[model samples]
Structure formats: C-alpha cells, structure tokens
Target: MEMKTIYFAGGCFWCMVKPFDSFDGIESVKSGYMGGHIENPTYEQVKTGTTDHLEVVEIIYDDAVFSFDKLLEIFFAQIDPTDAGGQYMDRGTQYRTAVFYTDETQKMKTVNYIESIQDRFDKPIVTEIRPAEVFYLAEDEHQDFYKRNPERYKQEQIDRENYIKTQKNLS
Candidate 1:
C-alpha cells in the first residue's frame, strides 16, 4: 500500500514521536526541525532561539490504514493548538506548534480541521499550517528513545507516570 506523509511540530519531538509511532497505520515517525530560516540547524542552535525552526516530527503512514483526517485528530489531541508559545513541558520558538502540509490536499484538510475546532477554544489556534519544508532528522540517539530505555522513557510518558511509580513502590 502507498504511504502518505504529514509533518507536525507540537513541542519536544521526543513526546511527539511516540504518539504517532503507536498508531496502527503509521509506518514511521522521524524527529526533525522545520519552519526555520537556517539550514540544518543543530538541536543546540535551534534551542538557543537563534533559528526560527520548531521541533517537528515527520510521520510516514499507510493511507489505506489511516486517513489524513485521522492523523490530524490525533495531533490536535496531543497539544493545545491555541498556545502559540510552546507545548506542555517544552518552551522556546523551536518548540512551538506547527503543521507542515506537503500538498494542497493536506493543506485544505488541515484548514477544515482547525476551523471545526475553532469554537472549542477561547484563543485562536496558533498552529501554522504550511507546505512541508526540508526536514532535518534528529541525532541517532534521539531515535526510538522510548524503546531503548524502558525505565527512563516510560517515566517520561505522562500517562505511565502513575503506573511506573506504583510498580517501583515509589508512589
């Protein structure tokens, strides 16, 4: 089956990567930086707020198994679109929320989705929906972080915090 691509920046590419990877239809998720003026900005350079980039995750998924709309739904649930600053625990211009669409189809779909949810929030959605730019993959160490260090990564999971604490008798 053919696959489609969607790129999103909701903050901490670490947190963003796992959610998409868990989706049954998703083929893969890549941590990257986008919407920036500089080319191939390092994690440090971007974090310093020198570059305009936002930490983004590029998702490759089978369109047959999951629709673009479905992906957008999941993305919306993961971050506060109205918060133009940054997501949950992350802060900085590089961690700001954004939606990078590859084509016109994805662009229109994103617009519709944002419009549908507009009234649900008091503030306007600050998510920037634009054409996909060159995506610079993060360092190898950042890839599959959750799988490599179960204990540490599991602790990072917002939902798994209580579960892990209880198991470790630290609750």
Candidate 2:
C-alpha cells in the first residue's frame, strides 16, 4: 500500500543488487540505465561510456516495512561517495555513483542525508543527487549477473574483489 521507488547508480550494478535485496520491504531491484538522453540505450553503448546513461538499480519497496532513510544509510555504507571520477575498479561516467530521486521529497531527503554523512569523510562527497530520468533495463544476460555467472561469482567471492576494494577506497 505504501510503495516507493528509488534509483542508485553505484559503480558496478552486479555488486549493487545484493546489498539492497537483503533489506526488508524491497519488493524488487532492477538493474538499468538512467540520467541519459538516449532512448532504450544498449548495454554496449552505456558500458563503453559512449552515452550519458548511468548504470543504476531501480528499487521498489514498501515504506511501512523499511524507511527511505534506512535505504540511504545502507547505500552510503556500501559506496565511496568521496570518489569524484568513479567508484572502485570501475572508472567511467557509467560507473559513477549517484542517487536519482523520483520526487522533491526524495531530493530533499537525499540532500539532508548527504549533509549528515559529510562530516564522516575528509574529502567532499561527489555522489550526485539528481532527478530521476528515463530508465532502460539492461539485457536479460545482465540481470542478476552475480547469480547468472556462477563461475565468475565464485571467483569474485574467492578474491573478495569488488566489495573489499570499494571499502578500502572509501574515506
């Protein structure tokens, strides 16, 4: 009854999925592209940084089960907002971190949330807080990438790759 949605572009979409899915009230987490000018852009065009599209996840949740603030907290905990250029090993506009607010309230909440956590870091938080744009769902192959690519997922787990690197670089 109290459903809401939010968009987060945090580096690799593959690694971003599981974090939000773990929380309650998260009805769905869809990996897609947003904040771009093109229509229904392809993964190749976005991945190659040829388009303005950002790789983001669209999260639908029930506010009664989990507050948006809690979502922001978990999101900030996972990403290095201080990184201006990009996040972790992924270096490109598509890999950049951002919060695409669907409404004025979401925008205000995001700004306030950023202010609350600003003091925690020495450098400025470069995580862009902007209005939500058109979302283009990625190819089916990209959906639940970690689950689909078990061998790569297993290797990633064995190496502790993305998460470890992201945490280490966070200020």
Tens digits of per-residue lDDT, candidate 1, 19-129, equal 778777899998888888988888888888778988899999888998999999989988879777676556678878889998898999999999999999878999988
Model 2 weakest 10-residue run by lDDT: 156-165
TM, every model: 0.87, 0.89
For all candidates in order, the CA lDDT equals 0.83, 0.86
In model 1, state the lDDT of residue 78: 82
- Write one digit per residue (lDDT tens) for candidate 2, span 57-102: 9999998898899999988887889887666667898989999998
Per-prediction CA RMSD (Å) = 5.2, 2.6
lDDT for residue 169 in candidate 1, whole number 0-100: 92
Q: What's the TM for model 2? A: 0.89
Best by lDDT: 2
